[model samples]
Target: MFECFCCPVCGQALIRESQTLRCSAGHSFDIASGGYVNLWVTNRTHAGDSKGMVTARRRFLDSGAYGFLLNRLCSETAAFLRGRGEKDPLIVDAGCGEGYYTAGIAAYLRRQNIPATVAGVDISKAAVRAGAKRGEEVSLAVASLFKLPLCPASVDIVLSVFAPVCGAECARVLKPGGLLFIVSPGSRHLFGLKEILYDDPYENPPNTYYLPGFRQMRQFSEKREILVRGGQMNDLFAMTPYYWKTPADASARLAHLPTLSTPLDFHVDVYERCEDDAQEPPVCEHQTHNQ
Candidate 1:
């Protein structure tokens, strides 16, 4: 699936030899027993969600509370490929945590008998391992979004779900006219959670993305109410940014929430890479505020 991956060190093509991925330059990355590869170098900093966070997220997502969001994402992706007339597509799940959407999208294509490939990448090896548990439908890897391990112009579609977006990095790995589907949290996303944490909670601020060398193609707003029990609520809360931002007292309140209702709002924006010389002056990404 990752036959197009490159060496992070020398930028040479990586060939899978046994359980190791090596380039002609001799740079090698070992594949974990869990069916995932770690291609990240520069062990200077440890960023990304912690192992505990990954576990919590997996448990919460496995509960199917976000099933609607998952299904919508995969359906929209298939429609996007069909609309572009690309029968065989190579898709990337950027910042794929626990491989939820990664496996979901891959399985959707397989069920519809579409010829395509899906790969998942994240900076966290722990997260990649958990995601690998979903099986081999996805080529899992430990990679930084800032510098993806794939070769230039190698991928057709890139999916960024509730993850940080690196426009230049995405553009670099995508074909000249490739498509990028980014899912950002809408203003109402997790407003209920915030209401429980902050003294005066506010709606999520609109995220601003600047994608040069690309133009908006399409967008969709998805809003749903998720009802979660105490355990599920705890897992969901621990996996979010609020876990780090909320104080002890506010956190105490979550333990008492036997069942909580929250809004799951996502603004999915699609951008198409323009011809190298046809890109317009850079500007803010166009997005609708899903209330």
Candidate 2:
């Protein structure tokens, strides 16, 4: 299922050997018991989301508060894959977090009888471990989006949902005319929750959907209101960027509320990759590391 991983140390293709992925240069990465490989070759092991944050995200997402978003994403993905006319498509979720959307999309495609190879990559080992528990259909890798372990021109579609966009690296990995799907918060997203957290809440600013070596193909927006209890509300807050920056007083407001209704607005933007000879190649070395 995961035949596209490259060596982080030597920039060579990795061949899976039982519980390890080894390269031609003798560099190897061990696959975790949870069925994920740590391709993040760095001294800092705990980089991305913390275990607490992953737990909060998993709980909040599994509560079915974002079921509508998942359904829409599946539908959109199936439609795109059908139009592509590939017998077997390769889909990569650049920052899959805990694999909620990754697993959902894979299952949805299976129901539609579309054969797809899904790969989920995240910088957090904890998040990838949690993602592995979802299923083995998605190949989980603890790798950075900026410098993916994927080979050149091998992927069909790249999905980035509420995650950082890596333009040049995406272009290097995606085949000619490949699609890049970016999902972000739409205007007025989480406004209801914001109202309770702050005295003056502002609507979310417009999102920029531009990326190098890619042209905008389509844009879609969906919104839904969901009621969440205090515990679930806390989970929601903890999973977002606001939790770290919000004042203690603002956070205390949710402690007394029995339930809170919030709007979840998401914008999906599709970009088609274009050939840019001037585009630079992906940087393989992370701060000049040696094998």
Candidate 3:
């Protein structure tokens, strides 16, 4: 399933022996006991969610608060895969946080009689570890979207949900005609929660992403009202970026609300990688040429 991984230093296909992933150049990475691996070369410089944030995210998601969107994502993505005509698909969850959506996609695909191997990559080691604990079906790795651990043109589908968009890297790793699923907040997303936090809250602006080799194929919008109670409210707030930005009075107001019927919106877009007339050459160490 992870035959796509290559050594960062030598660009040779990585082969696994026991718990170690090694390439022809002798560069090696050890798989963590938690069933994930760290392919991060310079992870310290990257900004990823902290352990507390992952804990909060896991708690909030486990509540099935986003079940509606999750179901839609699975159904729509599966339908796309069926239409794509790949018997076995390799699905990736880019920047997957704690693997809730990743597992959801995996389960859906499998239930629909479609065989798919789901892998996930997140910049956060904590996040990857949490995801590894969720299931054995997913191969979780700690890596940045900027430098994907997978080899060029190796994946069939890439899923980015509420994660940073690295269009170039995503395009680099996808095969020609590969599918890219991007999920983002819509205009009405979280307006209910925001209204309690400030005197005036604005609707979320439309999100946009530009991929060099990708063109939009289709899009789906999902909106629903979610009734969040006190504990779940705190869980939601603590897991969101708004938690840090909101003022003290806002926190007090959110704390006081026993229940808030908040509206959530998600925009899912499907893009297909276009064929390159002249594919870019792969960079490798110890460059070889015919003598």
Candidate 4:
């Protein structure tokens, strides 16, 4: 089902050994029994997949708090593929944290009888390992988004849900007519948590960086207010990065929150690669000089 993978470094065929990937260049990466390979070679790992973070993410997702977002993502992705008349789409979730969202989408596709090859890649080995342990049908790999371990123009669709996006790399791996779906938290997402954690939430600014490589095709938003009560509030707090830098009183405040109704705002932006612009010079000239 995952025959499309290749060596991240040499771009050669990756042979699946007992629990590892061996390329023609003798670069071998061990695949955890959970069925995901670790392909990250960088020394600096992002703040992802630590035991506590993974556990928090799993607990929060399993609670069905994010079910609405997952459902919307699955439906939109499926509809997009169906409209394009594409069959057996290859999908990958970049920065797939704990595999909840990836697993959810894969299950949705399977229920619809859509032939698809789903793989979730992350820089966190722990996250991929957890995803692998979840079972088959979804391949998990510890790889960087900046350099995906796949051949050029191989994937049919790419999903980036609350994760980072490397526009150039995504465009390179996607077929000419493929689409990339990005889901990001809107400015108002998690406002309640922000209000409790920081004294000046507005001063920190928000993430509004947009990709420059692809043309925007469609944009839609999904908002749901969840009334998180009891211990689940703590789970919600831990799952978010806001808790990390929060003051000591943040946790206390969360614990005291009898009922927190926060908006879960997510934006789904679909973009198609501009084929004609593929051969054009660098769009960000400053990047060339920095290199």
Candidate 5:
């Protein structure tokens, strides 16, 4: 489906080769065998996602700690697309770390009999590389969200889960009748872990915020109290950003605890690009909670 992608370096048309994508201006990038193309040219590396961080993320996600959240996202996204009579949609996940959620959503779409082309892009080479190793069918790319490689108005659905959102870039790449879905942690998400980690746990404000270009269409929160026993507690802590900042004493405190139950609250927000002639907002029907 991606015959030509824009060069992130110069915005030129990047010609697709069997093994490399070459732009007219001599900027060439290699396409890995696992179905990912690296297109990042900048050096602004993320400190939080080093090689060890990516590994920790993959291990934690693979352990199924976040499987419930993944399943919810898939079901809701499928329902949203079905209600709009959208089939064979092209979906992109910006800042997709390790491809856990992206791959999960792709499988869910397939089960719903929806023809889907899912692409996951991240600036971290380690994250994208790990994602590419997952398998074919899901296209992984090493590209920044600020400058997506897709052409304007080319995508049908875009997802950003606990990651940065470039509203202008999203609006540019989304088709006229496209939807943008975002999943952010609620105010009380992982409160138990926060309490153990920070000396001032109250200082960590809620992470959810609305962006500028996108108008909110629908918002829902999923809250579940999960009792994590044994090693799962460590995995839970490792999967979150708080792990990076948590003090050694806090880590020890969590490590010593045999069992910890925490509340997991996630907010799913969907937005639609406003058009000139559109009069009414998009229709959103809430589904019964599967829990």
Candidate 6:
């Protein structure tokens, strides 16, 4: 069903047979019992999220704290597809953790009567396994965002939310005029939480939205206040980069907090793949963060 997927080893098309995917070049990958495939060809032992982190993220997302963001993503993507009159489009959720947005976008497009194929890829087996258990009508793969396992010029849209951005890899997979949506944190994101965690809380710096072989189309930014309740606070904290670097004292401060009222700021940048192969020189460093 995932015609867009190619062999990571040989760069050849993959054909599914029973519980295995094999390419003509003799490279084969086994589909896990969770219904997700592992196409991560990495020599590095550790990559992506751990099981604990994935669980936290899944719980936090399922609580619907990020519902507004999800709705905006679906609306924008659906509108783009409708405007292009594309009845069937291939969408890839790069670094899709637990398939929350992937499945959501696919379902939304279906409700709008737009049949689309959605594929989710992450570098974490734990995350992809959890995603497969959801039984969404989308393909899930354990693969790197920097090195996708999709065919060249095979995807119509690529979505990245709080994930790493690999401009060269994205350009290779997208067809000319395809769209790439990058969702990053705005300057004031989580200001309240930062205030409690750091003695001198500072606003997030602006992002340099530069990508090779891509031209800026438009941007969508939103900020909203969210009340973190129950265990959601810890879950939210675990999904952010602060969890790794925050001092123990800061963490203890957060622990004593009964509830966290933080401003959630997100910026969605839409870029269109250039028709010509010409690309601008690299202008900015890529930022990597937890999803």
Highest-scoring model, lDDT: 6
Runs in model 6 deviating more than 4 A are: 280-285
Q: For residues 1-291, what per-residue lDDT tens digits would candidate 1 score against the true structure?
A: 555578988888899888888999898888888988888897767577789988998898888877788899888778877777775678999889889999988999889777788999988878998999988578888888888898888888999887778887788888878889888888889888878788898877767679998789988888888778868888988877788777899999878777788899888888998777456554333232221
Evaluated with TM-score, which candidate comes out highest?
6
lDDT, residue 66, candidate 3: 86
Q: TM-score of predicted model 2?
A: 0.92
TM-score of each: 0.92, 0.92, 0.91, 0.88, 0.85, 0.95
In angstroms, how far off is 55's CA in candidate 4? 0.5
Minimum summed lDDT over a 10-residue window in model 5 is located at: 282-291
Clashes of 3: 0
Once model 2 is optimally superposed onto the true structure by TM-score, how far is the C-alpha of residue 228 displaced, in angstroms?
Answer: 1.0
| Residue ranges of candidate 1 with Cα displaced over 4 Å | 85-88, 278-291
Q: Which scores greater on TM-score, model 3 or model 5?
A: 3
lDDT values for all models: 0.82, 0.83, 0.80, 0.74, 0.74, 0.86
What's the lDDT for residue 255 in model 3? Answer: 97
Candidate 2 ranges with C-alpha deviation above 4 Å: 276-291
Error of 6 at 236 (Å): 0.9
What is candidate 5's CA lDDT for residue 61?
75
Residue-level lDDT of model 2, residues 118-162, one tens digit each, is: 899998889999999997588889998888999888888998888
* Residue 264 displacement (Å), model 4: 1.1
Candidates 1 and 3: which is better by lDDT? 1
Say which prediction, candidate 5 or candidate 6, comes out ahead on lDDT: 6
Worst lDDT run of 10 residues, candidate 4, spans 282-291
Instruction: Find the 10 residues in a row with the least total lDDT in model 6.
Output: 282-291
Off by over 4 Å in 4: 43-47, 203-212, 277-291
Q: Write the per-residue lDDT of candidate 6 for residues 134-162, one digit (tens) a residue.
A: 77788899888877999999889999988
